[model samples]
Target chain A: MDLLSDLFLAKAAFIGIVFAITLGIAAYSTYFERKIAAFMQDRIGPDRAGPFGILQPLADAVKMFMKEDFIPANSNKWLFIAGPCLSMLTALMTSAVVPFGDTVTIGGVTFDLQGIDVNIGILWVFGIVSLGVYGILIGGWASNNKYSLLGAIRAASQNISYELAMGLAIIAILLFTGSLSTKAIVEGQQNGHWNIFYQPLGFIIFLICAFAECNRTPFDLPECETELIGGYHTEYSSMKLGFYLFAEYINMFISGAVMATLYFGGYDYPGIDFVTAQFGNNIAVFVGMGALIGKALLFVFVFMWVRWTLPRFRYDQLMGLGWAGLIPLSMYNVVVTAFGILIGKPFTAGIVGVVLLILGLLIHDQLFVKKKIA
Target chain B: MVISNIWYFLSGLTLLSALMVVLAKNPIHSVLYLVFTFFCISGHYVLLNAQFLMAVNIIVYAGAIMVLFLFVIMMFDLKKNQPESKSSLTKLAGSVVAGTLLVLLIALLRKNNLPAPSEVNFKSQTGMVETLGKILYTEYLLPFELISILFFVAMVGAVMLGKREAGERNF
Candidate 1:
């Protein structure tokens, strides 16, 4: 009874903390995005709100809430309401399985920073994130508009196509780590060598897929303003629109954390062992948590950087990249990784895999581009 | 006690949703209900301590398959063109076939003489990913490889079927 109560209390606290951090960071990401974009383009951004627009997200929230909530007359009312709700729900759900930090020993009891330490943590994230596509699909279908329908269809096809490559890429990392649990994977990387060193090709493929999954540029064709206006959420107004937009930022934050956890070694920093030896366990845990958050934030910044740096892909180009480029490349990565493990030279195998990937890309470019030119 | 209660609730919800999937007037509503049914079934898998199965079920069935179903339904615009009801003779034949299958299933169950329910070993790691992987590679290796071959054949068949004819305009 006592243990159960303690578990409940710890879980509740962790849930509250994670929920707050996810929402808070997601909200502020908007401000950071604008600021980053402005800086990249040589302009000051959102300086009107409190002190360099620190309160811009809050102001935006207030504005969203105050705006009139409109539903198109021909739209399916219930599904319209359910669309953004489902998006927000699935976006938030992915955070539950992600380990924010290693266990912290508070007094006599040790508590995990993750909300729930499900054994199949990575699979759980994938499953929940896959469901996030429904939010766009249903929202667009409910809107009773041709543009919205097109956007939703495009989003669905793009997500499903990229997910195949993403899953294949993850298989290579899984072979190296030999475990599906996020905690186990993170712990395996505690010896100063992150998975990125072993699975560089997989990381690149996974990063591209993550961008597509989050519906960010250059894969943000679903909502390309020049074409589809507002895409799936074209008919949404007020907080409904806010929910769809917020869900994207939240997805970005979760994917960033996932990438950090998978490739960059979650919460594992250089001299972490030294810090643990000098300070206590609790302090070390906090330091690790900070490191993880910093890694995640860097990934988020990269996400924004890419968003600003690249233009959107045309629809056919996006599909071709996913199916022809990534799928085959990821498959080759898995095969090379497996062969390497068999030969007992995993590092050499990874390097060979990367070399083969580059060679293949050049060959593909020469073959396909030359044909098109001719 | 808590586990049993949760199981009962999940099973009940699953049955209700399954029924709704068939009974719903709108095709979209039916797809959504099917998704709900999948979720409830995943909950049952979790209750059985098959966490990997639960995740796969959700990812494959609820996430991918249902999304495809929804996409197809959206494309058809069924609301604008509701099909006529089935003929009475066809409905009668379907019911008869379904009834016969149900009776045969019940008869087979009775003949099996199943043992009384055993207490679940919640702590057992039988359904863990590692255990499943070992079984798949060792005992079930041939069957697993065969399934992959089957999937490959199916995929090739689909691509063949879907290919555009020469000189045909896509539109």
Candidate 2:
């Protein structure tokens, strides 16, 4: 009972730490995204608030909070309020399953550097992310605006569409690790045996689906300003609009963490054994965690990079890419992964994936060429 | 004792939310209540230590299906077209049908005289993913495969119906 209680206390504390980390990273992501965009576009970014605008997010937060909490007269007040609350809640919940670092022992009491350890960690993330649709859907419907409704519908469809391919893509990881737990997946990838090398095709499909699921460009038609003015959050003002935007950033952060954990040998730095042998487990654990965070941040940079570089896909093109392209590719990956496991040659899976990818590119090229001729 | 208390609370919330689903005036409110009901049931599944079932239940019902329900309901102009109220006779007929279902359920339960799920001895691992997956793919492989094929067919049918023609927008 005492041990259990102590464990509970540790868990509660870790939850607080994880929440702080997720929110802090999400806050800084906004700053970094702008800085990255500015560099890409050859312009100076937000350098006003503090050194290189480190305090810009804080300023933005204050501005968001100080602004008038406006609601349209015709809007469904209750659901309008529920929308952002649900959005933020679901985005935050996905962080609970991520194993941040190895355990730390003090006074012979071990503390896990995770929010919660569950056997179904990845599935829990999946389920929570699927629920994220309700936030935008509710907010859009409640707004009583055409653009909001249209955006919400598009977002719901987009999320659901991409989820199919995403689940199938992750099947390759599950095949490789043979476990649904994120910790187990990470453990399987220890000493640089990452799933990415084996499941490159799966990773690419997952990356695209992740982009779509997060509603980031080139899949961000739901919120593209050129088409729909503010889209789903059109009628939202102040913190509510901030919640929608912040939720996107949070989703991006969480997805990046998930991708890192899934494919980038999470919490496993190169020469980890040497580090642990030299500096001790505590220092090594910190280094491992730092590496993991650095990796997640790298993926976040990729998200922003893609957002700035790629143009938004037309609605049909986006749907066509998801249903016609990624879904089939993912299913093929699943089949080849099954065969690779059966044959006891993991490299066979990578080879098959590459072969299939080449064939797909050729087919798409041929189709494009024929369309041009016609 | 605390566990039982949580189970009771969760089951109570599940029932309340399920009732609210039928009673809510707004279609969207009804859908949301249904989602809450699914969530509370997921809580019950967690209480029973069926983590996989809880996740799948929430994912399939509260997440995917309910979102589609919300999507369709959101598109409807609710203020313009109110549902027509049934007459007294129609209400009586509906109540009669519901009453018959209740009576049949009671009779079936009394006939079986089976113990409640809580009273039955069950293993902690019964609802685990490994056990479930093994049983699904091994013992129930054919049925599982058939059901998946059925779903695939449905998906294909949806795509066929929704497929865009030349010079036409699908959406």
Candidate 3:
């Protein structure tokens, strides 16, 4: 009983720490996104609030809190309230399985830094992420507006279509790891044996799907303000609107963490073993934690960078890309990976992935670009 | 004792949500209630040491299917074009069919004698993915492949239904 209680307390403390970190990263993500966008476009970003807009997110929060908590008169009141709450809930729930560090030995007892490292961690992520569409759907439908409903429909269909490719992409990774646990998957990638080297094709597909799932720019069709005028949250106000926006940042952060774990190596930086042997597990743990967080933040930067670089996809183009391009390519990736694994030549998939990508770009340039120019 | 208490609470929630799914007047509300029922059933699966099943159930049913249900239901302005009220004869026929189902369920329950929790035993690994995978690949390979083929056919059939005819009129 004493040991169980000790474990419980340790788990609770770790969860609280992780919770704070997730929110802190998400809050700063908003600031970083604006700053990056401004930098990309050669304009000054928000610099009024506390030194290069360091306090901008806090100011935004205060403003959101102080604003009127308004619901549309014709809206379904209960569902209107539930939508953003559900969005925020699902966004935060995924952090439970994300392994922040390998493991920490405290007081001679080992504890995982993650909230829960269940054997089915990846499945849990996929399941919860799939449920995220419901929040947008409910919000859009409850608003009782044409634009809002259209936004919701777009979100729903987009998520469903992309999820198939996303799941297929992960199958290649699974072939290598043969385990569903996030910790196990990350552990397998240690010592510079990152899955990215072996499963390059799968990584590309997963990255695209992750972008779609997060609804960042390019795939931000659900909230295309110019088109849908605030999209699913058009009828929402104050903190409700804040919830929707904040949820996106949170989703972005989680996606970054997930990508870092799956492709880049969670906490397995180069010389991780050397550090552990020299500095001990406790000190090494912090180094690894920093590495993972750095990788995740880097991903967030790339997400924002791409947002500034690319234009949003047309609805039809988005559908066509998911169904016609990514799906078929991911299926090819799976077949190539299966053979690669069977033949004991792990780099076979990587070589094929590079060649396929180049061929695709040439085809696109030759066929599509020439047609447009002519 | 604690497990039993949790079981009771989850089962109660499941039944209540299942009831709400049928009783809710609003179609969107009904779908939400059905989603809640799925959540409760997933909770039951977790309690039974079937984490894999619980995750898949939520992903497939509550996550994907229910969202599609909501998407379709949202398009209709149900209040403005209230479902043309059913006649008494139609209502009577619905009851007759539903009543027979209820009666059959009760009769089936009465005849079955399930082993008590203490009497039956199961390995903790029984429901885990690794063991389940081994059993599936070794013993249930043919049945599993056949089921997947059935699903593929059904998927093709759905596409057929959805494909627009060239001469079809558009609103």
Q: Model 2 clash pairs? A: none
Considering only chain B, report the TM-score of each candidate against the true chain B. Answer: 0.84, 0.90, 0.83
Per-candidate interface DockQ score: 0.64, 0.61, 0.62
| Residues A1-374 of candidate 3: C-alpha lDDT, one tens digit per residue | 35468788888898898778889999999898888889988999999999887999999999999999998899999999999999999999998898989678888888878888788999999999999998899999889888998898999899999999999988888888999999999999989999889888788899899899988878989987788998888898999999999999999888889999999889888988789899999889889888988998998998998899998899989999999999988998888888888888878657876697789889988887746434
lDDT, candidate 3, residue A82? 97
Query: Which RMSD values do the candidates have, in order?
Result: 2.4, 2.4, 2.5
Looking at model 2, give its docking quality level.
medium
Cα lDDT tens digits for candidate 2, A24-115: 99999999999999999999999999987999999999999999999999999999999999999999999988888999887788999888
The TM-score measured for candidate 2 stands at: 0.94
How many clashes show up in model 1?
Answer: 0
Q: What order do candidates take by DockQ, descending?
A: 1, 3, 2
In angstroms, give how far residue A121 of model 2 lies from its true place. 1.7
Best by lDDT: 1
Sorted on lDDT, best first, the list reads 1, 2, 3
For each candidate, how many residue pairs have backbone atoms clashing (under 3 Å)? 0, 0, 0
For model 1, residues A1-374, the per-residue Cα lDDT tens digits are: 35468878998889999889989999999999999999999999899988888999999999999999999998899999999999999999998888888888786788999888888999998899789899999999999998999999999999999999999988887888888899888998886789898888889999999999999999999986789888888898999999999999999988999998899899899998789899977888899888888888888999999999998899999999999989988999899989999999988899987887679779988887756444
Question: Candidate 1, residue A55: CA error in Å?
Answer: 0.8
